[model samples]
Target: MSAVIRLLLRRLGISVIVLIGVSMLIFAIARVIPGDPARIALGPNAKAEQIASLRAQMHLDESLPVQYGHFLADLSRGDLGISLYTNRPVTKDIAQFLPATLELVFCAGIIMIMLGLPLGILAARYRGRWPDHLIRVLSLVTVSAPGFVWAVILMLLFAFYLPLFPIAGRLNDSFDIARVTGFLTIDTLLAGDFAAFTDALHHLVLPAIALSLSGIGQAARLTRANMVETYNKPYIEMAQAYGFFPSRIARIYAFKPSLIPSLTIIGLDFAAMLGNAFLVEAVFAWPGLSRYGVAVILRKDLNAIMGTVLIIAITFLIVNIIVDLLIAFLNPRIRHSARGSA
Candidate 1:
């Protein structure tokens, strides 16, 4: 098999193992935690027969292994059980809120790549100069504060004081667009409603920037550090001796070699941003999975909590796998080494 195929299979195998382990751990924790889930979900007035039936459906009478098997079975069918907090299926609730969270994260990731990386490259290109110093200082300031703090600051400056953007919610309530895929941005565009799309994007700007600021700082710093090191390599010296344009060397030679390490961290940052979205979402009054997750945890909604945690865990694994594949594609050494091992 080709190295790429082998690498993909290897990552897939590892991700499966990790996901199974996470499921087992989360399943065990959800079960052992203090309250009777079925009773809680059903309510105090629920009949004894109802509670028994619910427990049976959850495989509560079975052994731990059997219960786990049933959990996996239900998961395979996207059945996460009824959520006590929402009085809806956990799966259904996630479907409603998850897209908003994903859209926010996706925009943040774009900001990280488009803004952060180029700033890092610029800083490295003009090391010891004013631009480098300015960018470095800005990055430190950005990273010093958490996402929620940034969210509040952004809301104050852009939404309240300056009144440049909306302070809360995904869109102006006036635009009555149907939820085709639950993503307002795409749904509006699909409906060919430019006004709603513009409004949705405007509302998204502050939250996405708030969430991405820290990631951007990290990406910038890591890229600068990596590229600075890359600059010292003999290859870079050779490129300089050849009288290659500074921009060309920075773009082609230094950046690509340094990107592998930076990409790994970016993947981690992107995954972590999802968890970090809780406070930012709260600050923005954004309706997303993070908000739902907090609600579920506060109520000690067992199935909802497990379902949310499991979904986040799965997202992490998937992002990591994609990053690994990207890294393997970028660095031939990895693919060759994997092929050799195989």
Candidate 2:
């Protein structure tokens, strides 16, 4: 009955409706693409009878509406059907590669947050100074460059020229960690192999940093702008008058409030990295969903494409929802509504 609860329910309802609409759109678009899923599956040298049988198996013989209905029904049961390219269950294929992408994204996110926020705060606090100008220029350059550009430059500098890191892939041949979770870092730790975990971390470092650079720049700029505004507020002035340490006032009063807006946008950028991860993966030859997505799209694999698109959409939606919830918690208007009901 609380306003906070009501708001949450409303957001959840909207998200569900949006997801349904997205799925329907994806399903329609996939079918409408100018390609024969059956023929693609059977390859270029398929016999007539084989193509016919494959089409029948894929239910390409069914009417469009009927096929869409079947797709929706299967989706309700957590099945995205089968991939024509891999000839595996769509969900299984996604599961196989999704974790790798997720791992990269996760590490990238951590790097972005660890580096971006402090830099932003520092730049904002030091506004009109050399440090601020330097950070602004750096953030501008970083934001302008694409992830793939960073990936290549990083590879050329670190892998080829300096030979500081491995050129491609998730792990070295020497690692003997069990693939329990399919995440090399976690699997190595689970196997109690510190050496392998260290090696995996080293492999992950460059790619994660490359993926995160743009996000870090964007976050820094957003945070810096917001924090600059927040620093000029009456509360900030009052805190300064009260002899509050500049550091404490900047962090506790200015930075925290400014972060609400920055976090929301940053969450969206992080979600976007899921799609961008493809370029990074391709450059590194990492076996992530991004590479899988590119491959399946080229092959015109409808089910695989659908599954990948749907997953990315859901990830984006989920990130937005989390951002909303975080903002609601931080903003007194929403939090007080919940507190009042309690």
The candidate maximizing lDDT is 1
Q: How close is every model to the real structure, measured as TM-score?
A: 0.93, 0.95
- lDDT against true structure, model 1: 0.91
Worst 10 residues of 1 by lDDT: 333-342
Give the clash count for each candidate. 0, 0
TM-score of 1: 0.93
Model 1 clashes, total count? 0
CA lDDT for candidate 2: 0.87
The segments of candidate 1 whose C-alpha lies over 4 angstroms from its true place after superposition are 44-53, 335-342
User: After superposition, which runs of candidate 2 have C-alpha atoms over 4 Å from their true positions?
Assistant: 1-5, 339-342
Residue 78, model 1, lDDT: 79
Give per-residue lDDT, candidate 2, residue 83.
87
| 166-200 per-residue lDDT for model 2 (tens digits) | 89988888877777887888999999999888888
